[model samples]
Target: MKASLLSAAILATAIVSVTACKKDKSTPNYAKADDFMASHAIKEQSFSGNAAAGFTITGKDGTKVTFSPNAFVDGNGNVVSGNVTVTLKEVLSKKDVLFSGVMTESNGQLLESGGEILVKAQKDGADLRINPALQNDGARVEIPKAMNKKDMGLFVQDKRQQGGATGGNQPQQSPYTWNPAPYYPFGNGPNSYSFSLPSFTWVNCDRFYSDPNPKTTITALPAFQDNNQVTDLQVMLVFKNITTVITLPYDFTVQKFQSYQNSLPIGLQADLIIIGKDSDGYIQFGTQPITISANMHIDAPIHKATQAEVDAFLATI
Candidate 1:
């Protein structure tokens, strides 16, 4: 058995080496990236200290895989530490799939969103099979019934667009745009505010892993608010028609996590309710729907009015 395993490793190394040496740019081979991940399957990784401070592992093909601290958050919002085995079903080039988002649950179970292909991973006794929800949306969808679980992770990108209005495979626009118009109104004036159709933001834990280095921070998008006053910010995401709500930290503020929102995949949407008591002690309510695809500025003003007016404005949202 030992000899056979050694021989298998040698043969696998040779196959990946050949796959990497291919010189054709027009039809570059991805079998090597796929193969390397298969041979080096990580059953469980152990981390100490801040597990939320994620780490990156570099594959033999130089692919850097990073995981956000939230990726390991349990259902109760606690960061997972200790020995956790995450299997890669398959590793393909960025050009292979349309949309792919991988998230691990509290028990370290893997969930794949978008993309027709399904990779199977096992946790405890249940079979983590391919989901049909991601297959319903786009044109020219191809759902592979099964995939190799140990190499399931595609190292190229987290989000991708195959064919769309822009024509061929192209990256989508920035998730958040910098605009200072929080007071901008929607339709008419003080009471009637216009709103985009509601979409939920995914913000249970704002931490993200864009790179392998723990010290590397996200600095692209700007801050939303300066002071941290409002807490209990929450966002939701829908997959396969199932709604999943994610909550942000109690001290979360617009300014602290606007940039984090900017890093989310384009096309994800969110909704927010603005309610409070006025100086006169009367309760006021306001709401706005936020889209994270191309625009980031919240121009709609929250109307502080009667319950009826608030309900009307919320109807538009």
Candidate 2:
């Protein structure tokens, strides 16, 4: 029942209060950000179809994907046929991006993401793949225009390092990175950005963050109740002047969340948000307005948050 972000200008104060407001009866005490997202973010949609006849599926947000006949192939290079299940998860907003923990970047370059979608198919219980014959513009994906898609190109998940706690319980994480997606012509229609995807994986519509402004590194410090007890906190930089969101990774060596070197543009305005679970298993968040300066640092004092409060705050981003 706590509605702090809506009428309260979604955290109107700089360095907003970072103390617990009491856990909402509906919010669970989760120890990991992955667990929180799995329970609360958008759920995947599945459709039953036959690979021999082809099928088309749409997401809850109007994301459309079409699989051609015999498009699915199983391991050992066998073509799958009947009873194939196609799954899709659409991440279209800043809220979805954060809760889903999907990062938008390519080989260390920042991206202003328009949206992202996970397309997958399976036969019975085994994983399937797109036939090599159709790997080049074989399957088509059309994401509805929800946010700005200017200069957006196709990008796909190329690699990701393992995440979770290290041997010493030091929470370790490396956000997955995307690469210049395959040459599957990108088009911007009136209502959607249409492109062809060769295989089943994560596809993102993103544009390289191009700015000539002088860049610098930015660091964030999370206010921990126990001083330095590491939790599942997630920190992100949300740009006010442009549609860009980048997650800051925790530097266990320095005990701070930091971004890429020479990444932030000097003089640009932005809001830094730190939200995740506490060591005690309660959801907490902090927000502060900031102007990028040379070697800038931010100290975010996080407070308790309910599921509803989390949703409202994400909507504003």
Best by lDDT: 2
lDDT (10s digit) by residue, model 1, range 42-137: 333222223335444433322223443423433343445543333332222221211122221111111232211222222332332212222211
Q: How many residue pairs clash in each candidate?
A: 22, 0
lDDT of model 2, residue 71: 86
Model 2: ten consecutive residues of lowest lDDT: 162-171
Candidate 2: residue 254 Cα off by (Å): 2.8
Error of 2 at 163 (Å): 17
lDDT per residue as tens, model 2, 1-317: 36756657656542253323432334454334455567767788988887888888888899988878888788988877788988889988766776667776554457888898998888778888888877654478889889674767888887643332122222234545777764778888878899988578888888888889998877888875444354666898878867677788777877778776676778988779987665656677778889999998887787765566666666677
Q: After superposition, how far is residue 180 of candidate 2 from its true place, in Å?
A: 0.4
Candidate 2 overall lDDT versus native: 0.74
Q: What is the C-alpha RMSD of each candidate to the true structure, in Å?
A: 28.5, 11.1
Kindly report which residue pairs in candidate 2 clash with one another. Answer: none
- Model 1 weakest lDDT span, ten residues long: 197-206
